[model samples]
Target: MRQVESEEFERLLTDFEREAVHLETRDAYGTAVELPHMAKWAAGEPDDLSWLQGWCETLREHGRAGRSVRRARIVSEPLSDYQRWSHSIAHPMVDAGEDIRWVPRRLVSGVGIPGNDFYLFDDRTAVFLHYAGSGLSVGMTATEDPRAIGLCRTAFEAVWGLATPHRDYRPV
Candidate 1:
């Protein structure tokens, strides 16, 4: 890979922050599959292969750069088969001593309803609506009040703290 200058990297980050989008997607296994598939494509790898290799490449790159990558907290209503499969692929970051978190439906309490499957990046700027066996759609605007994001993060922490590793995971 060509080395990116500091200014170029900063510019890239700025652009990502300014135009970042988020999605509110369906809770489906295909959504999970897409995450890794995109990763592989980004690394010029065969899209058919599991993003397992790309994920490791990312970790190594971050490690070499002394950067830290945080895992996401998935907040969903009732746990579904797709969520379970998603966890299987996403948990490796945590297992490798990188920071990854999750909150599944089975562990949540005092929650009125489940939040939509959404992606929050650039600190909740862009969210994409992911679906199974179809194209992705745009998610609604995440409220400016970071509180919603905070709440979701908090709930994820709560569930993540009590949830088992994928290796030990059983159906939700």
Candidate 2:
């Protein structure tokens, strides 16, 4: 797996021709970018989702370009604070033309989920996210290994099939 910078990862999203799929396996992601938003969410402050405007625009642009974006999040029952926040804030993505789904971890009994979260582009390239134990993102690795790409595609599809749409999934 070749390590890639975050900018390169973003470029893959922009460059993909068909679709981009994301598999999120973690219950919490303690990234610097999310910390403040999470804090506000935890405090019950009304979220001003203007921060998502840029990402929403990106998704919109992709949609306009005939590309699809999808995400499947594997979450545990009795959702973590971060997960709840994530679920609550997903409407912007939906409005921007991205499809998001949530699969309860218990439902994935025999599914072979990868150790790290990943983004698969056009079913060809896979970018795996490495995170510290504290849930902080450390780095990313991108590869076109058929084995890796196939694994991610299979796992993501499995979860996507079983997951509930964001509108129907209520966080605990």
Candidate 3:
């Protein structure tokens, strides 16, 4: 498991030839970049998501190149503040050609999902993002191990099949 820098992780998205799939297992992520938007959403104010334009554009570019970007988020039943905020802001990504889905944690009881969040690229490279106790991203581990990639691909597909699409999911 070689630790990868954040830039390296971002590079994978642009470098992948076929698809990029992500599995988010955390209910909340304490990233400073998102705090302001999350606060605005929590306060019932209109969120200014201009900061995400770059990312949205990246997804759009991938779509133009005939690549796919998809994500499956496993969230608790009673949504956390972060989860609610995330749901509220998911439209931009969807509009940019990324497919996002939400899966209730309770429904994943018997699923053999990995504990950590990860991004699998082209079914070959798996980059597992590590988080601290407070949900801050610590680092990422990149692996090309077939066994690890197989598990991630299988688990993500299972969740994707069971999860609801962003347009249809109503957060609790």
Top-scoring candidate (lDDT): 3
Q: Name the lDDT value of residue 115 in candidate 2.
A: 85
C-alpha lDDT of candidate 2 relative to the true structure: 0.92
Kindly report which residue stretches of model 2 are placed more than 4 angstroms away from their true locations once superposed: none
Q: What's the alpha carbon RMSD for model 3?
A: 0.9
Write one digit per residue (lDDT tens) for candidate 2, span 1-172: 8999978987997889999999999999998978899999888888788889999999999999989999999999999988998988899999998999999999999899888999999888999999998999899998999999889999999999999999999887
lDDT of 2 at 170: 83
In model 1, where do residues sit more than 4 Å from their true spots?
Answer: 1-27, 31-51, 63-104, 111-114, 118-144
The TM-scores of all predictions, comma-separated, are 0.46, 0.97, 0.97
The order by descending lDDT is 3, 2, 1
For candidate 3, write residues 28-72 as lDDT tens digits: 998889988888887889966899999999999999999999999
Whole-model lDDT values for every prediction: 0.46, 0.92, 0.93
**Which segments of model 3 are wrong by more than 4 Å?**
none
Least well predicted 10-residue stretch by lDDT in candidate 3:
39-48
**For model 1, which pairs clash?**
21-126, 21-127, 22-126, 22-127, 22-128, 23-127, 23-128, 23-129, 25-130
